[model samples]
Target: MDHIVIGTAGHVDHGKTTLIKVMTGIETDTTVEEKTRGLSINLGFAYMDLPSGKRAGIVDVPGHEKFIKNMMAGLSGIHLILLVIDAGEGVMPQTKEHIDILQMLGIKKYIIVLTKVNTVDEELVELVVEDIQEQLEGTLLEEAPIYKVDSLSGTGINELISKIDEESQKIERSNSLVSPRMHIDRVFSVKGFGTIVTGTLIEGTLHVNDELIIFPKELRTKIRNIQVHEKNVNEASAGMRVALNLANVHVNDLSRGDTLASSGSVQKTWMIDVKAALLPHAENPINLWDRLRLYIGTREVLCRAVPIGVERLEPGEEAFLQLRLEEEIAAKKGDKYILRSYSPMHVIGGGVILDTLPTKHRRFNEHTIETLKTREKGSTSELIADFMNRKEDLLTSMEETASYLGMPQTEVIEYMGEMVKKNQLIKVHQLYMSSLKYEKLKKDITAILDRYHKSFRLRTGITKEELRSRVASNVKSKDFDKLLQLLADEKVIKNHETISLSEFTVTYNKYQLKDKEDIEQKLKKAGFTPPSELELIGDNKERKELIDSLTGKTIVRLDSETVMFKDYYEEAVQKVINFIKQNGKMTLAEFRDMTGSSRKYSMIILECLDKNKITKRVENFRLLY
Candidate 1:
């Protein structure tokens, strides 16, 4: 069944509650305070079965000036408005304010209702209708149908009901395939249910035992039961007014304006980019950095608006703005929001969210403004590409993209596959990066290696750790390794223990070459007993560089004061292995005698062989494994 919410908007004592009571046969106002004061202080709900066999949810919003915040909360999921105006008093102050709010909130469908018709004369009724028509000129409700009804006497009630049923049939149901999102408007502890939260499901579906996250606090809970229209249900979909009994959360932890959503489906952000317009009836021009109250979904947060490329926003002007919120909120692209002044608290302007998570932008940055404009009007693929491009240094996964875009993972996977096939995105392992970012990283890697080669002429290449730190520190280790391997496969770079450009090779000057040859010959002739540092170019920086280069190439070993040539080290290793294979094991003293060297040299060679895993030491004897 298609579920739609019709909300009441008008001034206090305009008979909104009475009209709903007579129409639905359910009294919305249940609180003692409301009955005693004869005014609503919070949102009250009821259900009306239309003549078309469709059920519509009724949200009766408080119309008093002090409770407008509560009214704003109830307006988030409304599909149509029942704007009430008392025929005796036409449009009052709160009535005009409510109209302004409805305009700002982007509610275009409504039915003008003139209540208390029996209390006014026929001429007064016609005059009031004329006054309402004039007030609605150039507004969303300009062409809305007008009906004068006396709820106390049941006059014109049947015609109003038929009209509402006709309008309800025209509204399309929300898609259930999108991730579920519900902004909590009421939270309480039921006698036997423990904790329950009620709201209108905006999208997707919620089932019993479904895990959900309360955002901004990220509290995890499961649905113990689901209820719609005071009856139990196995599952509920988008556009339904639902009450969920939560399993693991307490009533004290929940509050009005908190959002319940599918895990990882939405993100809480402190900054957003918007396309806003100041209302023509605004009393004051909105200056840059002006603090205002931002309302989206059921959330109301304090924020400062920084107008793009302008000093002050004159009344009736549209501009791009960056809103820095005082608290975090979970929102998505295309979500509507309303801004009210901080002091007098009247609706000033409203807009759609262009980017939910955005970096701080300069006031007059043309590129930023252009990008936001493109995102606002872009296609799904374009928006995904823009999201990837913004995360330049990090690889975005398909799951992450789904969450950021408020899309399902399966759909995101399909889009990503298409993007990869078109070469618009590069898939490295399971992570994704825009083609532009991949190309830029490739260039950066080459440049880093080129600089490293120039700075360290004696070194073979930079270590893998060093290269990653310089070029791809933000990338995951596995993803970074895969990227490097991919580069190596393309022959664009070489990778081993170190990474270097495929075209790069170590080169030496004439003097350095001569010194390297000298050192090699000396070590080669020394056999198993190599000379100490003091015996060969002691404390010389040039000779030290040569030693480091040789070690890097694995041509020599610099162990403390001992320097062993690679050839001799291999010889010693073979001897020990042969001795152990023949005798099953060899002792340190026996190895010393066999190599014809002192204990110091024998121990050093034995330790080197052990380090290389050529032999394992058991007690005082060494055994080959």
Candidate 2:
């Protein structure tokens, strides 16, 4: 069953409160001031069982002009609107303003309820209905079903309730796959319960004992209890009006507009990029640096609107804007917001947020404008690609990217997997890069290797550190290791202790080859006690380079003073293993006698065996490693 929150909107004293009472049999105006003044001052909530057995939450908003902000606060989670118009007064000023707000905030459905039909004659009632129908032209409510009822007499009330039930089924259920987030509109402390917050569960599910973070302040807390329509439940689903009992928190620490969400999901921002437009009858154009009142998700903030790609946004003109906020807010992409004049708060315009986390963009930046347009209109996959392409060479992680896109990490990974197959994205180990960036990086690596090979023909490869510093220094160590190994697997590069192009090899002139062969023969002839490196180098620098290149491949450099040919080194390793296997251990004297070498040579060779893990030294002997 779809959990729906329906909100009441219209002029003051339009019978909104009494209508809710007639529908739900519950008095919504519970505050003493409201009872005394006979007007709603803040939000009032009630629920009723519809014919379909779906419990529809009813939010009663203050219709007075002074409390319009309070009205906006409760309407954030509403799926439908009860646009109340007085039968005697027809369409009032606040009714018009409320309709504008509803349209701007993206309320998809509304049922026009004309109250106090008993007080008006049949002709007057028909005239009022016709006037409202004419007034609703060019709006989402133009074709809305209008019902005339008298709350005091309970006339036509059942028909309105049935219509509401029918419309409630039309509401698109909130997605439970997204991370849960709720903007706290009320926070108070009960005597036994620590901190209790009331709001609509906007998306996902909140379970008892689930860890939560309040954004904009980021106060950490846990859910101790969950309630929907005042009944405790193990979990609350999206679109339900929720009252959360929060543990380890205080009423003073939280306030209205603080978002309760899973940690690292919803972001806090002091700036946002949006596609803003003005109401058709707006009084003034939006000028640059115009301080405006921004109402988003129950939070009212002071912000400066810097128009993009235009100097001033006239009435009914659409433009991109970067709203520089005075206070931080927890917002996500596609959240609709209302804009009001800074001093006297009246709805001037509103638009949907395009980017919650955006840099301060200068006016008239074509690229920035293009990006905003795409983000506002593009599909989800396009949005991901656009965001990734903007990152240049940086490898994006799933958590951060999902947070920015306002999606679950698992869901983003699914989209990313498809993109990878389409060659639109590249998965480099655990990180993500745009295919454009990946191709550039691949080309850069190949060019660097080409230059290195040409610059130093005798060198086999470049150190891994040098390659990383040139390719992308910010790449994590483990990611870089995986990247190099991947390149080697693709046959684009060869990775060992160092990295090189797959086709790269050390080359030597005929004279240098003679010196390399001469060094190899000397080491082979001096098998038991190979000549030292310096002895082999003698006076030739090129001989030293050739000998150094042969170290780990054809020669095992035992120490600075001792070296051995690869074959002799293998023979000595086998001898130590054979002796240890038969005699259990071998001493330096035994090896010296066995090989007919001196004590110095024997000690060096034994120590070399220990270094190579061919043998382990006991007290005066060696054992097989």
Candidate 3:
């Protein structure tokens, strides 16, 4: 059966509680204090079955001014509202306040109910109806039907039930794909049960044994049992008043403002960005950085409202704002919140959240304001695109993006796949980058290689580490490697131990050619006992540069003080092979004698042969491998 929540809203002694009892045949007021005083001080829950067989959960909220917070707690997850008004008194202060709150909370469906109609004359009842119609002229209830009913006598009750059934058929059930969110309005302990918390399931579905986290505290617990409308159920979907018997959670640890949600679905944040509007009946203009009480999803927190791009927000004016909260709250984009004055404790303004997790923004920053505007008004894909574009060169993971946007990771991955297919985003090693940023990185890499080629014309290329240090040092090593491979595949650059422009090649000038020749001759004449690099260069900067160029090109091999030309090194290898073949195994002294070189040169040559795997030292002798 489809489940819908109908919340009562009105003034003190307006018969909201009494009206609910007559209609549902279930007494909502169960607290001793409420029963003794004949006034509800906390939220009450009951359910009724309509003639059409639809189950409707009823939330009877306290109407006294001091218990407004308690009333606000019951307002979350409501699909339909029953605005109860006293026929004898017409509209009162709390009545108007409740209307303002309902509107601010984004409630669209409602039916105005004039209770205690039998206490007033027919003429007075008609006048009260006219007054209600006038007050609802510009609100969501302007076209709503107003019914007169006496709760005690059940007068006009059947007509009201029929209307409710008709309206319930039109209201769509909440989407089960959204993450499950239940705001705890009441937390208490039953004799046999561990800890029981009751609230309306606003979204998704909760099943037995489901692990959930209570926000702000982030206490982890599991659902031991589930009850909907006072009956055991294996699962409860959105729009049902549910009492969850929780395991590993103490009643003392649970609070009314706490929200139970699927793990990783909600996050606690101390700051949020929103598109806010001050109510027309606000008592004072909201200046920049004004402290206020923020109410959202049954949570009340103290926060400061900072108007974006303006000094103050006048009554009824809408603008972007950043709320700096004094405590963390679990909130998300599109969640509606009410703002009340800190001292006067009256509803002043409210708005929908644009960003649940946001960095501290500077007031009047044009870019920040423009970004917020896009978030407020853009489509989902557009918002994701903007988020990626803002990241620029930094690649964002899907998890990070999902957390930032307050969406599920699976949803974010789906969107990212679409973006990648459209070429609007680039995916490298599971990291995402905007197309613009990818192009910029490619360009920067090309420029860096071009500069390196120009500076070292006599060398092959720069080392990969050096290239990375110069160009993409901030990029992750794995991601940078993937990017380099991509560039190599595109023939934009060449990747080896070193990176260089694809078309780049080392060229030797006349001076460099002469120096290279001179160095080759010196190493060749010295044979295996070549002069040390310092001795060969003799402080000649040009010679040193030439030596470095030759070594970089693999034209010269240097091992400590010994240097060997490539061709000569090949010849030495051949000689060693010949000696080993002829003698089977040769001692180091015998090798030195055969090489016709000094002990130092012979030792270097033997070491090089050993390193190249040409020969192995077997104690007193060397053997060719």
Which consecutive 10 residues in model 3 have the weakest lDDT in total? 552-561
> Each candidate's TM vs. the true structure?
0.80, 0.84, 0.76
lDDT per residue (tens digit) for residues 117-228 in model 1: 9998999999999999998898899999999999999998999999999998887767577788999999999898899999999888899999989988999999999999
In model 2, the Cα lDDT at residue 200 comes to 92
**Which is the winner by lDDT between candidate 2 and candidate 3?**
2
What's the lDDT for all of these models? 0.87, 0.87, 0.85
Give per-residue CA lDDT, model 3, range 278-335, as digits (tens): 9988989888778899999888999988888888889989988899999989876788
Q: Model 1 misses residue 26 by how many Å?
A: 1.9
Q: Which is the winner by TM-score between candidate 2 and candidate 3?
A: 2
Collision count for each candidate, in order: 0, 0, 0
What lDDT tens digits, residue by residue, belong to model 2 across residues 304-407?
A: 98999999999998988899999999888878899999876779999999887688887877888878889988877898887777664468877667766767
Q: Give Cα distance to truth, residue 137, candidate 2, Å.
A: 0.6
Clash pairs detected, candidate 3 = none
Q: Which ten residues in a row have the lowest lDDT in candidate 2?
A: 385-394
Clashing pairs in 1: none
